[model samples]
Every structure is written in C-alpha cells, then in structure tokens.
Target: LIADEYIKMSDGTYPVLFVANKGRNVLLGREAVMRKEKMQTNQIVKDDELFERLRALRRKLAQEQGVPPFVVFSDETLREMSGKVPLT
Candidate 1:
C-alpha cells in the first residue's frame, strides 16, 4: 500500500495493514464513500429521477455506438450514478 510512512524490518520485509478512513466525508471520494455504504448494508438506494435520465442517455449512446445499453453503462453503474445524481 502506498502511504506517507512505512517501516522496514531487519529481514528487509515491509508489511502493514492499512484501512482507508471509514465514513469520513473528507477522506473518501464520492464513489468510494457510496461503495463502502453499499458493502456495509448489502443494498443501495437509488434516485428514481436520475435513474430514468441515465437510462435514456445510455439508450441513446448504445444506439449511436451499435451496442447494448448495458454495454454503455451496466445496471450496477447506473445504480451508483443514480445514488450520486450527477448532472454530467
């Protein structure tokens, strides 16, 4: 793990357990925060409006690219995007 500091033993082995600060809004990126929430709860709540909008965008992109909507954005990705309600 890349860190600000680590120690080397006499045997020249470097090993340490590190955990990204949990639930600290300043510590994790938006996706990482939401993903951690999902992992803990086993479910993620999605915003319906964002979900529909993303679906429409994905459908359009898929048609233009001649691929399936899931190829443009999988269901899991859509769900996460919905949770974030990203405008872009």
Candidate 2:
C-alpha cells in the first residue's frame, strides 16, 4: 500500500508499490515493476543480528557519555558496518 519513488529517475519519479507480505520485495525502475525473484534473507538476518549488537554497544556507550545512541554512531553507519563486517 506504500507508494513512493524508491529510486532516482532522470525523467521523473514514479510511485512504487511495496508488497504487503513480502517486505520490500517490489522492484521499481526503468526496466519494469515487479517483485524481486531472489531474496537473501539469511544474509539479511545475519546483518540484522550484527546491527542489533552494534546498536546495543552504541546505547551502552551513549549512556556512559550522556548522549544519544545516534551520536555514537548513526543507524545507517551501523547497518553498513554489520553488512560489511570489517575484520580490522
């Protein structure tokens, strides 16, 4: 039921419909509009788990410093870190 231009378009933006049950499974672009054929749910779950862990750490640090958790590290940054899982 959600409608928004999820991707950038040079000509003009068009509304894209997100599937109710599939969780962002809809694909919208110049080519076509449809549901994504492949979904990496396992990797996403792992990344989400890591993101939660990072968030917990951020919360703890923020509490100690008397600042917001996002001040320690934004959610977008944490999400990227979780997906990459940098060794260093």
Candidate 3:
C-alpha cells in the first residue's frame, strides 16, 4: 500500500512500518524509502538539438517576412510542438 504522509519521530525523522501475517512486523526509516525521481531520462529528447533547429527555422521565416521571430511563433509554442512530435 502507498501512503501520502509518514509518521514523524522525535529526532526529526519518519518511520515506515510493515505489519505482516501472524503479527510479524518490520520497521524502516524515512531515509530507506526516500529517493529522488529521475528527471533526465533516456526517453526525453535533448532540448538543445530540437530548440536550435526550431529557432533557426523561425529566424529564417522572420527574415523573409521582415518581422521579429515572435511574430511568426514563440519559443514556447515551438517547444510544445517538439514535445508532441506531430507529423504534418
């Protein structure tokens, strides 16, 4: 079972308890279960490559239209498109 909050102790620590069959039990501390979620996973694209290509295209279009790049499209919009990888 997953829990949202932990039981705190006197020494500024938290406890995790497991109760088992026939009154068998185990206890672990907060340090044992706590871990940082991996943010830079292999599945995510390298933003620099995608963003650089997008910015270059935007700059070229802006120059042709005689306007600033933001007039064509914002970086955030381009980043969202990169994230979605939409075809056509």
Candidate 4:
C-alpha cells in the first residue's frame, strides 16, 4: 500500500508511501486511490509519437550498454529532456 499526506493513521503503515506537498497539507491513502484487487495502468498518450521514439532510443542505448532500460535513463528523465531540448 502507498499513500501521501492526509491519510488516516489508523489505516496502518504501508510498505511504500510517498507524501508530497505536506506543507500545503495534501494527504492521500492507497485505498483512497486504488482498490486491492484492481490494477491501474496509465495508457493515456499525451504525446504518443514523441514518447514512442524516445522509448525506442532508450531501449537501443540500453541494449548497446548491456544494462537495463532505466539504467540508460528513466522515462521521466527522457520526457523532461524532450521539454528542455528542442529538436534541431
């Protein structure tokens, strides 16, 4: 289970939790966001073409380096790069 701020302490401790915006007092609990039997996947493609290209490049670099895909760079990192670096 995972949670953020505003979670009731009575809910018990979770193996993993990430609390953000604590200063502003934002809280969330795993059960509040998800069901135990259900799994949620993010399939929404905000930028499908660009994201696919970046994923392919990341996979190629990882194979060449003989490391895991994330070792080359995380998807989040690549997305950030896309925003910071303009295509030339």
Question: Candidates' lDDT values, in order?
Answer: 0.65, 0.67, 0.64, 0.64
Counted clashes in each candidate structure: 0, 0, 0, 3
lDDT tens readout by residue for model 2, 1-88:
2344443323337654434433334433334356658865533434777888999999999999999998999987887788886678
Per-model TM against the reference: 0.48, 0.45, 0.44, 0.42
Error of 2 at 9 (Å): 34
lDDT of 1 by residue, 1-88 (tens): 1232222223337654544343333355543422234345554655787788889999999999999998989977888877876567
Compared with the true structure, model 4 gives a TM-score of: 0.42
**Model 2 off-target regions past 4 Å?**
1-46
User: Which candidate gets the maximum TM-score versus the true structure?
Assistant: 1
- Backbone collision tally, model 3: 0
Q: What is the per-residue lDDT of model 3 for residues 1-28, given as tens digits with 9 covering 90 to 100? A: 2233343223336654544322222244
> For model 4, how does the per-residue alpha-carbon lDDT over 3-82 read when each residue is reduced to its tens digit?
44532233356544344444124334333343368687654445667777899999999999999999988987777665
Query: Which ranges of candidate 4 are over 4 A from the true structure?
Result: 1-46, 85-88
Query: Counting only residues 3 or more apart in sequence or on different chains, how many pairs clash (N, Cα, C under 3 Å) in candidate 2?
Result: 0
Candidate 2 clashes between residue pairs 3 or more apart in a chain or in different chains = none
* Residue 83 in model 3: lDDT: 77
